[model samples]
Target: MFRTIFNTVVIAACFFILTALHAEAAGFKDVPKEHFAYDAVLWAQKYEIINGYSDGTFKPNEMITEQQFAKLLANYFELEIVEDELKKQTTTEIWSDEFYNSLASYGVPLNGYLHNSIRSQPVKRGVVAQAIAHLADAQQNLNSSIEFLLEHSISTGQNPKYENRDLQKFFGSTNNMTRAQVVTLLYRMDSMDFYYISDDAEAIHKNEDNNSLNERAIEAKKQLDASLQQNPSSSNLWNGNYRYVYQWGKGQYERNARYVTISSANSKDFYVRLSAYDGKYEGTTEGYAVITSAKKAIMQESIKGNRCIIEFEHLNNAIKVTEIDCSAERKNGTNFSGTLRKQ
Candidate 1:
């Protein structure tokens, strides 16, 4: 009798543990035990991809806004948020600017959906499908994002009536994705771990040979070095495109950038093109710079009767521009004196 009781108690304990695991999201009072999204919500909560309200309610049926979905994807992908103090107090910078810009850097098109005006509005399902297609690396030969989702068994559209079973689904692309549906979509995608976006921003992706991101970068660098060697007659390394993304105190976000392009002009001189545009103002000038030292050059240009002389100090894959009386080349708060990285 003692052995029998012990075996029964052990089985009962196992059953209890399984039950607890099954209802891992029971902490959310609004999520019923029979809810379809219980498992997905639990998974999302576990991974910190989604959170509940202050009242401890999951509200799984609530519609996710544009910013909310951006935050969700950021949490899932561990994307770094880049904030500019210059953009903080501007009239054009919205709360979701960093999140959207970060996602855009990863090649997600804005498509007029992530703008500040509609940031609080419900994000449509079409945008979600596009994100999934890009995230899963299913972007090849894709007629449409919806078709791609169906082909990959990632989705079967929002809902459907009785029809030909194979060709029977219509994903209301404009419909707002519910919280439960968003989590469920993420949970259903089984191909999230194949392609990894490396921390190196310039790493090339999408290779038929399956070369890793860093390996591709190595190959690309080798090719670029060869090209630069051919561009310059000698070992001069200043023949490439260099740019620095800058954010002005004004409302300009992406247009605020300084660019420098150097090309071999002759045996002793290099053609340099410099431009700085910050939406509110624009300045551009191109001239020839003669080699001064092993890693330095001087360029002179007269713009609107103002003699402009600038010195270029070349570094490893960068150039520092020092302006000397280049006031005519710069106008209305436009200045192109900064260090730029090789592109």
Candidate 2:
């Protein structure tokens, strides 16, 4: 009798162990065990954060819509979608009204969401970065959110204008993000512990909340300050990544984003690539600027025989853009003139 009971117990234990080991294999026709997002898919499944389709297939490659993403985030975070947290604005999605309201109430950066046809549009990766950064305790702005993701091991995005790649990776990508990519991001975030800049440039984590103050932005500021001290007024020092976000309402405002890249610098001037992007809208022009002053450089282009001038001004930790009749190049109500902060 004793031997029979012992054998039964051992069998049960073996079954339990096998079940536990197979948990990571998330049962989906499309997701194989060797898939890069397998672990994330497993985690998302465990938490019911994102689920597969009814046909027993996870369409991991499907493009996620903006409203759908917003709702997914709200549910994943278990945020209270209060009705009173309403945002008085245009570009509202009549469907999934709660999700849109929650996004506004939560103060998540409204990057491409504010663009027209909010319901049918796909959310940009920048929007994803901003929302995730907010949850990770970063400031509620595009630049800060982007810096947070980079500082944290969440993403690696290099502007395509500089890189040879066709599509921008990470937060800079204007392309629509896939469902699997987002799931992988969430999985990394949930398992991430700390944010530390290592000498080897590898991902490191320590604290759970990551409340430790971000030192990268601090270090960058210090470096710029030191450079300024060395040369009080130098346009050559202005070669760095800078971006800005602007918003306007009710047919009377400007809602857009601008990014400028300056590189390959000499003492006199440097190469500049000015790009404007907001989901479906984009305009780009690159040219060499000969520095005529310590804080300003101007580029001239003729649009339809009308001379258009673009000015770049170097300020302390910021770059100011001023355009004279560059409207022909602007799209989706984007104005390239604004105060952009260093990333």
Candidate 3:
């Protein structure tokens, strides 16, 4: 009888422990136990992907920022943010370099959110969908993310208008995403049809082949050779001073009177000095001492020395700057297009 009672008691204790764990998994008072998102909430909490507020409430409707979501994804993937790398990217100093680099490394498109001060703003639902779709290797169309959600039956279309309610509620692409919604989407990422596998033999082989520094050097040399073939000669491209007006959008332009003066050149580095004046604000000078390559040059404003990525397309007497990302240094509305010509 004593042995029988002990065994029964142990069994009962085990049952209680499991029941308590299930309850704790989705225990937020605000989230009903029978809510559709209850299981996803439980899964996220179980794996520490999210935490509740100090008051023990998971405010499901609260919006999440890009940085916050990025951090959560970083935690999920076990990627470490490299602070030094982020420092080298921008001087806006709003977000750490690691925050940007880590997201880029994981295939997140920084172009959508990197150009503005809106990184701290709440992320939109469409963007959340895009992130998930990209991770799942889904083909990205203009509406791919929205289509992914709809095709998977994750959301229904806009709610039908009812009497006395003219506002048509939509599950459209640009809707603001709530915390619960984002978590549910993340939970669904593990579904068999949506999950991405990194174990493909071709991918593994490519990764292994690219692992060597020597191999990367060789690839870069090949690119340089290819570029040289197209341009034929970069002989006069870097030796003298060039003047270019850096205009971005409809905003006040920058007067770069003496933009870049190359001092020396080699296969390793092309050292150059740059100078510019803010067209909107006279006497405001921005200068930079930078080392570039035959194919690309990057310059930062002298005041803070933030970064701007410059890609060069060398012509006979002029080097056309095809693209520039000077978002960190310039105010909104500055035109990003410009040309550099030998003076």
Candidate 4:
């Protein structure tokens, strides 16, 4: 009787170990129980795009850093790292040779803010938007394929819309995400059908004959207008300057400023001034840099010193900046200079 009991216990231990191993291999069993991003985490894991911590825990609720995300994307997409010296230099707070090259090779859009340092912060929705847009631009076929897959998934009942009544329960009573934007995202994912706006004479007369799409478009315009209102100078296509100061803590502060002006009329080029100030009196200097932008990507002699290039998407309002072999010099803990060209 004693021998039989011992054998049973040993068998149970082995079974539990096997189960744990399987869970780790699948990358799901270790994820936190309370993560809001559980679905996204599982999807990424299934695609072999991300991995859990070595300690058998997936910290799904934790914020991902910029460098970590860059590496993750680079590995998943099989981006190549260049071996040039300029590409390898790692002096600035944001500099990462491998990460930069990998991101560039993957056609990831680099904002003027991405210099040499990787930020340890939560990945924002806007970054996701930018990355997805870049991926869509890079592989046109991939976007359509993914879209079709999403459509099929939705059609097969994989995605279900929350009932209108449940919206308050799930999203809270005071949440401001418009019904239109929700429907639009869902429709694009094939999870929900578009809500039609009635065009009946009485309904039309009540609301000026606005259809659902028209109403949504108007809302979108309003939201865009509000954003522009916050940064009114950005509306000027030719010249603009904006500045903001933020306090972090005792003896720590920062001033973020940007200025754009016409650099050369002959080449139709524009120069942007980007600077960051630090400390109590804003007397301590952090860094200062200048970059140029133009319509074309080519390096025209008329705009030779500029190392940054700007391109507008077909939508016109969407802008992208690519930094080239720009250089910077620092002095007196407050003064700095750099040259960049806009493409």
Candidate 5:
């Protein structure tokens, strides 16, 4: 009888251990082991980057707020908060108004989420993308953040320009982010090099004589430059209003165009258009090119049936173009020359 009782207890103990191990692999109730975001979600949970509800459901479909995500990043990067709190508040108190204030002190914008009033609103995709970019040491401006997203492959395809207030037109910018989406982005961002500073901005930055702080800034710049080279600037890096002169030959008059608009969505592709012109060319000439490298681009343009192959070389902030067809007035491959200066 004693032997049988001991045998029963041992079998139960073995069963319990096996079941416990299986649960770890199974993950949260809503997120099954086979879910596509299972791995990322599991990673976040394991590292205490995110949490499930009291009901034991991960609620992967629920929308996430900007403040909520801010806390997650703050905790993930171990950003030293300047606030002190020991209150026994309900729910997520760390993601409160004080938390955002603390983050802003560290140059971390809440990304339009602001304080406790609008803090409950769901964070838009654009906001999350921008915040993640800032965490990676990208510039705080919207353009740089968008470019950072393009470089990191977070936002695929062309990085088109969009007004900050006009978020609806921007692709993937206006959508309300789901919990799974937030976690997945965090997972991707975590894989990159991240840097942060304490919320006490006055101590480190204001004290210019601090050698250690200056060294850190130098190191940070080096790392940022390395990251920039990895993606390379977008072809649109040079896009903007320009003042250009088109000459038939050396010092010969062709036309002078003011406010020429140059636009390139991706680093490898580009477009140039004359907004308003005052010159001999009655019609218009539109040129497009494919950037071959950091310093060279292959351009093609046809001006009134004149086909020319133009090569572009990066000269400081401006681009110098040399045309192959030297003879003027009519040839299939007539060359010309021009200079474009950013306005």
Candidate 6:
């Protein structure tokens, strides 16, 4: 009886060990892996487009820096860098390192707005869209639908907001993506197709007038030109007229300001002033203002210069403005002020 019991116990131990090993082997089976990104990473890694961490884990969560990403693109696309040419064009520091300089020379817009901060931020989906679109445009391999989407995406600033359901709808219910979709959207902005449909059939029919990719490109260019006219200066003084007061506080007041007349003929120069007032203790107003743009409006207050600087761009078919800095000086207790007009 004792021998039989011992033999049974040994068998049970073997069974438990085997089960544990099996479970361990299958542990990651249910984990949704980014196979497409993984494949890209592998290619990137092999080509030194990316590298793993010191701990040997590739923390994809880490923001991809603009500089690093530019280099990656340059390497993949074999872009050339012209150091002397870039230096002559802009005072901005071109990533002149042998690898990064190539990207700069490839007309990548590494100057002014396309600065280096892109590297430190986790590579956003929208950025991925832009990059991919750029690549497709360069290669002339972009499909008409993809081209339309890319142009619209950049002009309107639309980026992928990956909802699993949305992904499934676009990529199919398999929840798996082909290398084509992954690479195109990941590297080329011209990979996805997008359309704007209003709640009414009339709007849809009207949009049909500009349905083709070429038409869309023309429209986008026109819009960009209009935008440039509106905001001629990379940094400019935005003016408006006071319309109605919205809110007020002890040292501050908010009002809707109208445009009296703008010095610049650009419509972007004209805005409905949502102004805030701070008492005469400081030369500047303690409140903020909102200026609407083709994509979105902005709310900002003065920090250091004569005015506050608000940064904006199109993303995901909308305008997003970020408050960059504020400039207000305290003078002998008088606020620097302006007005708005109706017509």
TM-score list, all predictions: 0.45, 0.46, 0.46, 0.32, 0.46, 0.31
Q: What's model 6's lDDT at 310?
A: 46
lDDT of 5 by residue, 1-343 (tens): 9999999999999999999898575458668777767988988887888887653557565456555777676667665665433222123444454555444434443432222323444565656655566556545555566667666765542224654543334545554566787787667766764434333333433435543422433333233222121112345455543445444543223444333344433667665443323343322345676788877776565434445456666666566666564233233223345677753
State the lDDT of candidate 2 residue by residue for 1-343, as single tens digits.
9999999999999999898878645567667788888778777788877767554556565456556677667666655554442332344446566665554444444432333233334456766776666555644455666677767777767564644443224346454566788878777776675222222111112223332222321222232211111111233366555667555533212346666666434567666556665544666656666667878877665323434467888898788987655565454433446788864
Model 1, 208: alpha-carbon shift in Å? 20
What is the lDDT of every predicted structure here?
Answer: 0.59, 0.56, 0.49, 0.34, 0.53, 0.34
- What is the C-alpha lDDT profile of model 4 across 244-292, one tens digit per residue? 3343543323332111222111333333333334442212111112223
lDDT of 6 by residue, 136-241 (tens): 3432212332334434453222224533334312322212122223333333332232221113322322345545322332322232211121222422233211
Model 1 regions lying over 4 Å from their true place: 1-26, 83-95, 111-114, 138-143, 159-169, 190-343
Roughly what TM-score does model 3 have, to 2 decimal places?
A: 0.46
Ranking 1 against 5 by lDDT, winner: 1
lDDT computed for candidate 5: 0.53
Clashes, model 4: 17
- Deviation from truth (RMSD, Å), model 6: 18.9
- Order the candidates by lDDT, highest first — what do you get? 1, 2, 5, 3, 6, 4
Off by over 4 Å in 6: 1-36, 81-85, 88-100, 110-128, 139-343
lDDT value for model 1: 0.59
lDDT of 1 by residue, 195-287 (tens): 344433322222345544334323322321121212113433566566666654534333466666665444577766666556656666767
